[model samples]
Every structure is written in structure tokens, then in C-alpha cells.
Target: MNSESSAQIDVTKPHPARRYDYWLGGSVNYEADRASADAVAEAFPTIHLAALENRSFLRRVVTYLAAEAGISQFLDIGAGLPTAGNVHEIAQDITPAARIVYVDNDPIVLAHARTLLDSSAQGATAYLDADVRDPERILTHPNLLATLDLSKPVALMLVAIVHFLTDDDHPHDLVRRLCDALPPGSYLVMSHGTDDYLDIEDRAETSAANQRSGVPFQLRSTAEFSRFFTGFDLVAPGITSVTTWRPEGWRPHPRKEAVSMLGGVGRIGTRAVG
Candidate 1:
């Protein structure tokens, strides 16, 4: 941890990143984070499964973009703690020269930025201490420019983060601004929380629990989440539950309702979707 970011670390309050880390069985969380995570889990018993499935969605999508879509550059926003399989690790494994720029607002993430910066000999990685709400800042940041060439196709990773932004934040416009900055062929890979899969009672309970957990969360419906991909062409198996989004072969997959998170990949086209 750098001296600057060390001063910003507040263990007394639970941060979304640390809370997520706790859910992912990471040891970098404080008591407050664990308590908050447990509180949400009490209402939605599958909360831990959701987190793990979301991580799996990330790995699968990165593989598709690198191995199938031929995308070599990535701009991953809302990147959480340094985990086992990160964007660069998976992308670079397939395409050694892949470059990635990660963005996150958490001070703890900044403290562990070094873990994200370890890139392959043929690739590069850079982390920015920034928030998704300010897409302009992220898109225009010097670090992003230094690492990625915006004219080419770059996979924009927004996994499990936009739920933190309520309607008041105008999340659509923020996402549009970032996507607009990228040229055609750039891809948008996203996984968002949705209440559409839950029963009315469970939805209400989960919403209330999230409110009390000290983390901002808003679960959008499929239609609402789909609006974020207005100008891009969705890839196959479009906008399905994360568990069902191309799950590994030959095995029975979890039911969509069980996870309650929707994910999709969209390719930027020369013209908007009509």
C-alpha cells in the first residue's frame, strides 16, 4: 500500500470491493465487510453463488473476446480485488500481446494495484484509481491512453458493477460515453444484477437487505439492462443468465433463476442497432 492510498483505507466501514472479496473467500476484508456480506447473504442465500458465477462469467467472456473475437485490448471498469483469474491473465494467456487498463475507485484496490500490473512479457497492464460514474475521466485518463489504442477494438468489461449505480446516476449515459469513445469493432462485455428471476417476495427482501448492508445496489430488469447495448450488436446466447452464458461443456448448468444475474457481450458496429 502506498502512503497516499494507505491513508484512505477505512476498515471500519465496508466497501463494495472488500465486501465482494469476502464473498469470494478472499482474506483482505475487514470485519465490517464480512458482516455486510453476511447480511446480504441472509436475505439472498445464493449471494455467494452469484459472486462466484459472476467471476466465472468474466473468465468465459474474456476467453471469447481473446480467443474467438480476436480482441487484444481491454478496458475493464469496476475491476475488483486481485483474484485468481483476472482479465489480463486470461486474455494474455490466449493472446500474449493483449493490453489491459483496469479502473476502480476503491483505495484498497489501489493499494494492491501492483498485483494487477504484473503483465506478460508481450503484454501490458495498468490500473487507474477512478470510478465508473465518471466515464469521461476514465476514457480520457493518461494511463488508458498510454496502454490502449482507442482506434482499435477493445473489450470493455463492466462486470457486476453498474448495479451500484442507481437510476439517478444516469448509468446509461455514462456507459454510452465510454462506448462512444471506442471505434467500431470494440466490444462491450457486461454482467448485471437483475430481479427479474426472483419471486416478488424474494426481490423485496433482497432489495431491503441490500439497503441495510451499507452498499448501494439496484437490480434492473432485462429490458432496462438491455438498453445499455443500444448501439452494439449482441453476440450469440445474448443477454442470458451468467451461468448459462456458454457454460463449460457436457455438464448440466444451474437454472437461470438460481443466479439472478444477466450477462451479455455486444460488438460495436458501424451503425446503431435499429
Candidate 2:
């Protein structure tokens, strides 16, 4: 691990990013994250499957952005620890010249992201230690601008990461500012948590449990989620259950009682004809 102050992993408290890594069975998490995740798993029994499905969506979205959207550059905001089929890997698979810039505030993730730098000679990858609240900083970050040409169309990925931002953070405004900075034809791909498919009591309990765990989650309504895509044209399927968003034939038959996660991909500004 990079022992520099910037790369010192904060293992003392429960971090949402690290807890997410734990849920995905990665070794980059600390005891605090594991404990909190275990508590969350107890509250929502299907959390493990949900995490897996979210990661699957990340792969699908990146593949679509690179192949269908013809976007050779990507800005993955709130990127967690590097894993299989990461944005650079999936994007480069379609176009060898794909360039990816991962932004995250977690020092541990930043340390592990050094491994994500080994890209094909035709492609490039870099990580930035930046927070999502500062869109300008992320846009102008040396690592990000060096790898991705902001002037060209780029896919902005915020998968399974925004729920961590509380209302005080003004998540919608943050997204709007970021989108405004991008040129026409840029894409915004997102997956968010919701209680739309959960029962009344279970939803309340889940919310309470998350609050008690010190990472309060905000599950937006389908309409609230769609508001983030205001200036964009949604793709064919539109916003719906993440599990139902282009499953690519690997459908997990959800229990009728399971709470659904909301996911969708939208094309920002002009629609790019494939």
C-alpha cells in the first residue's frame, strides 16, 4: 500500500465504499466495514444478491457505453475497489483505445487502484482521490483529464454509489452540475436503491437499520430517480428494476416479496445514432 498520507487507509470507521467491497467478497475492506455490512445483511437478507446484480449492471453499462454508445472515454465517479470486468477492462474490450478515469475519496480504494493501471498499450487508466460533491475538481483532476478527453463524449458512471450521499449533499444538483460540464452525446448510467418493491414494514425497518448503522440510505421513488435523468433520453427499456434492466439472459428469478433496485441508462443531450 502507498504509505503516503494521501494513500493511508482509514480503517477505523465504517465506510460505505469499503462495506460495499466487503459485500462483494473483496479483501480490501476492514473490520468496521465487515461489521456494518453484516448488520445490513441481517436487515435485508437479499443484500448479497443485490450487490452481485449491481456489479453485473456496471459491466453491462460499461460494455454498452463502449460498444453501442461508441464512447472511448469514461469517468467512473465513486469508483470502489478495482475488480473483475472493471470499467477500463470492459470498455477496452470493445475499443482497445478506451481510456478510463476512476474517481473516489477512499484512500484504501486509491491504494488498490494502482493495480488497475496495467492497461493495454492502446488504452490507459488512472485513479483520482477526489470526492463526488466537487464536480469541478473531479472534472479538472490531473489524472482524470490526462486519461479522458472531457471535450469528447464520455460515459459518466454513478452505479450503486449515490445512495450514500444524504439529502444535505444535494445529490441531484451534484449530478446536474457534472452533466452540464459534459458535451452533448455524453451518457449517464446509474443504479439506485428503492423500496418500491418492498413491503411497508420491511421498508421502514430497512431504513431504520441503515440509519442505526451510521450510514443512512435514501431510497428514492421511481419518479425521484428519473428526475436525475431530466435532460437525457432514456434507453429502450427505460428506468425499471435493476434486475430487469437488460439481464443478458442471466435472469435471477426474484422472490415476489423482494425489494427491487431501480436502474437505468440515459443518453445526455443529443441522441447518438448507433
* Candidate number with greatest lDDT: 1
45-116, model 2: which lDDT tens digit per residue? 888788877888788778777878789988888888877778888888899988888888888877777676
Off by over 4 Å in 2: 1-7, 255-259, 270-274
lDDT by residue for model 1 (24-86), tens: 999989999998999899998888888999999999999999999999999999998999999
In candidate 2, list every pair of residues with a backbone clash: none
Question: Cα lDDT of all candidates, in order?
Answer: 0.89, 0.81
lDDT of 2: 0.81
Q: Extract clashing residue pairs from model 1.
A: none
In terms of lDDT, the poorest run of 10 residues in model 2 is 1-10
Q: After superposition, how far is residue 111 of candidate 1 from its true place, in Å?
A: 1.0
